[model samples]
Target: MPISEEHIGRTYPATAPYEVGRAKISEFAAALGDADNPAYSGTDPVAPPTFAVVLASAAWGAMFDDPELGLSLSRTVHVDQRFAWTRPLRAGDEVTATLTIEKVRARGTTAIIGIAVALSTTDGEALCTASSTLMHTSEEDAA
Candidate 1:
């Protein structure tokens, strides 16, 4: 099934606020081969640049779950991801993310979907914006 064009500009609901923790930040740094930098992995209050993924992972589901879009996760391939931070997020701060479908384009048996998720505080302060570009190739196209 093809993804519906109508859902292109739809904005999904905000996810529950998440509190950043030092442990999680450390874990991410370790996974990325970073050996705990002071600004990102210390007890202080700074997070790595890519810390936005914590909220993005929670927000991307809204796009894949769009019932009318008929997007098949199994057939999707993450093409690229970009993030623009208005400010860095600190541990222990609660933040929410709202997902928006930015664009959709089809190519042969494949499709490209762009989604932008905004991470912000509960009081409506903008934190950062993450954009994901996904390529969906039908099984037939793979074969």
Candidate 2:
């Protein structure tokens, strides 16, 4: 089934707060081949710019798992992703993410979905806004 136009402005539930820890920051930076950066690995660690994706991806998952959305992760291709941050994430910051579907367009057997994810501190301070475009190919042609 194709993504429905009626779902364009839908917003999903906010994710549980995720606490940023020094070990997790170090692991993420290392996975990005940035372990040598003092800012990400030092005693007082500041997460790199792209670290917000960790939280945003979780928000995206909620949308993907929504039975009403009719989305199939196996048939989707993430086309683009961008992030805007108010400040660098640092170890000890507890944050939660909420996702909103901004737009949806269909072409032939493919649907383009726009998603916006907002990350905020547990206390409600805005942290980052992450946006993505995904191309979900209809399962009928998955072969």
Candidate 3:
């Protein structure tokens, strides 16, 4: 089934707060092979720019779990990602992510979905906007 265009402009509730910790920052940096970077270590360390994905992914769960959307994780391919940040994410910050469906387009048996996740502090400070484009192939198209 094709992703419905009606999903566009829908906004899901904000996710539970995720606390940023120094150890997690270091761990993520190491996974990126950037452990040696001073910014990822010591007191007052900031997370890598792309670390917002950690929170954004959790927010996307709302969309994926919506039965009415009929989205299949097995058939989805993440094609693009972009982020706009007001400031770098730092350790000790409590963050929440809210996902919004921005656009949906169809071509043949495939659908391209655009989603934006807004990351904010528990206190309501804007952090970043993470946008992603995903392509979902119908069962027949995938075969």
Relative to the true structure, how large is the alpha-carbon lDDT of every model?
Answer: 0.83, 0.89, 0.93
Backbone clash pairs for candidate 3 read none
**Best of the candidates, lDDT:** 3
Off by over 4 Å in 2: none
Lowest lDDT 10-mer window, candidate 3? Answer: 1-10
lDDT, residue 137, model 3: 83
The sequence of per-residue lDDT tens digits that candidate 1 reaches over residues 5-102 is: 55688898999989889888778777888854677755676778788987887997877787677676788888999999998988887899999888
Q: Model 3's lDDT to the true fold?
A: 0.93
TM-score, cand. 1 vs. native: 0.89
Candidate 3 is scored at a TM of 0.95
Give candidate 3 misplaced runs (Cα > 4 Å). Answer: none
Residue 131, model 2: Cα distance from true site in angstroms:
0.6
Provide TM-scores for the models.
Answer: 0.89, 0.93, 0.95
Quantify how close model 3 is to the true structure by its C-alpha RMSD in Å.
Answer: 1.2
lDDT of 2 by residue, 39-131 (tens): 987677998888898999999888888887678889889899999889889899999999999999977778899999999999999999999
Instruction: Give a tens-digit lDDT track for model 3, residues 87-109.
Output: 99999999999999999997788
Ranking of all candidate structures by their TM-score, best first: 3, 2, 1
